[model samples]
Target: MSRKPMLPDGLSSYLAERWRGIGLSLVIVVATIWLGVTGQLGLYIHPRYFIFTTVMAVLGLVFVVSSFVYRTPSSGEPVSARRRAVALSGSALLLVIAAVTVLALPPATLTSATATQREVNSGGLDGAAAAEDAAALVGTGDYERLSVKEWVSLLAQSDDPALYADKTANVTGFVLPDAADPDNVFYVARFVVTCCAVDAQPIGVPVYQPGWKATYDTDDWVQVTGTFVSNPSARSADALAVLPTTVEPVDQPSDPYVY
Candidate 1:
């Protein structure tokens, strides 16, 4: 008859005994890889980090596979009693529960309400770049491609409305009514993600039109197309607001965040 192999003791035994933690770690690794492969990772993080996620997932799988080589402790084995008790604590189980919960839940993007609560920068362009960009765009007559961030920068840097006058803009963003602005004006905002959702910055363009509050509900995504006109009467005296010729409701983009 073949003899049974002896089990590991002490810390080695403790590590091997927590197989559930290893398994849950694998579940999380798989979930992350799936998100990255399906391009759903963009919902939580910037696209640039997807490659790093893939690398980490691969390393995790290797580590989990290697863990199986460790001999599990037998029930009758002489383990350090106090250390064994600590190894089987609630903290480890709670971590497994949290990991499983995250894996089970559907991914969701931050909403317009989140944008309202966050620090919003209409424009953060430096004075020099803002001036240069404002000058370069003066005669270009192109406006349809301008993002909410670009518009915000232009608004902050250029005090003159002529720099924006006769310029048309077509911007897509979710609607968030600026409670402080007139009923005609609402904010079209996009979350600018650097690394992940935690550091996302909300940047918006103010849309000016009467009765917009009644027409568009908060969080409704829309494509606002119109001329960029100076609205001195606007809440932000410096902003050259979009005078929307057509505010059409649109479906949200799959990757809604602006990188």
Candidate 2:
């Protein structure tokens, strides 16, 4: 007599119980194709998306093949052992792929300059010192709170001296692209957040200097040490301003996102 296959009794009945897994596999395949076609796959963990997608396709194929093979009565041997081995192997492979992809991806904090500044400023630094320094330069009479749109206009229309007459005003922000001029200037900006990073609206000052172009790229952390200079071409009627101080480059601090 031939030996029985290494499966529990009623193994054929048990195989029929797993239709849910097969259906799920079909759904996954459809979703993956849709995401890939729509260009939304980049929103996920970049490296793992493709690997997981491939795994889904393979799993679906395996289920289809297994279902067909197991349906044959003469192929007698219980498939339970083989099925369990396949399940365990696929699961282990998936976990390993996930781990590798996560490790290889670029850290999100490293890509955000605003995050870097917020992390440093939040540390037990001297807030009073910063405020006092700003006050001394802006002066009680000269310090004016302007709306973001107004600020943008002033930057576009006015010269820097109008705001920097006192010559020591302090401004803080991250860097953003300049729509008006890409080659010569960029916006030093900060995102104003209502609750967290999600709703942040960027506000920035336009920086214009021939030397700044050569010395710094966008997103570098630097302290501007110069007095304010007004640019007449800026949109602001109030005179768009910039600190002419030397830029002191700093390392990226932990918890880089501000909003």
Candidate 3:
């Protein structure tokens, strides 16, 4: 009878031991998927889905290579040492890539009002003013007076009445979709970029008051004077906030992009 093929002793065992790494890789993949679906990916170091997906793909390739190496026969040429070395090197490289990718990504906080403080301090009514107003409003217990839903409704209503009401305030941002009617109401938004445009996020206040369209185009630069209105049953009951105001067309100052 032909002798049974002698199997490598540690090969199977090594693969079993490395199963943990595979599990970890799977965890990362699942987490990436979850974040992408929930829009929570925008909260991460690299908010862009494509970036996150690329990093995950690299990791998956590493894991696949590891599995192949782990399953190779040990007795054929005793390449266990070389295989282990390669696995470790590959793992290290993958880790470095992930780290660098994350670090190099733009900071998602660019959309945050806190990140806009410098612009506000340097003679702009950007984030700093918004923060101050938000803080003051919150401090006076006025925030408790209206829910996020209420704020959206008040901002979406016909600006004709509000215009007559003389509701004028100041707001800063780029342009975006309107909360009430994206086609109708113009959104003044800012593209918040932490590191690059790849991970930039657009955040801003909605302007639906009369004459807003006349002064601002899709990407026109402008500073708006408006009033904050609150009413129940807006697009987003908890997050919709709008500013009904007269938009004053302004020059696109240097660094027009929020990033």
CA RMSD for every model?
A: 5.4, 13.6, 13.6
Rank the candidate models, highest lDDT first.
1, 2, 3
Indicate the residue-level lDDT of 111 in model 1: 86
lDDT of 1 by residue, 73-140 (tens): 45667666455556656546766776767776778888876777765663233446544664565447
| Candidate 1 global TM-score | 0.76
**Per-candidate count of clashing residue pairs (backbone under 3 Å):** 1, 26, 7
Task: Score every model by TM-score.
Answer: 0.76, 0.45, 0.34
Alpha-carbon error at 210 in model 3, in Å? Answer: 9.8
Using lDDT, give the best candidate's number: 1
Alpha carbon lDDT at 16, candidate 3: 39
lDDT scores of the candidates, listed in order = 0.73, 0.48, 0.47
Candidate 3 clash total? Answer: 7
Task: Output the better candidate (2/3) by TM-score.
Answer: 2
Question: Which candidate has the highest TM-score of all?
Answer: 1
The candidate with the higher TM-score, 1 or 3, is 1
Where model 3 places Cα greater than 4 Å from the true spot, the runs are 1-79, 109-164, 189-205, 209-222, 226-259
Pairs of residues clashing in candidate 1: 184-209
TM-score of structure candidate 2: 0.45
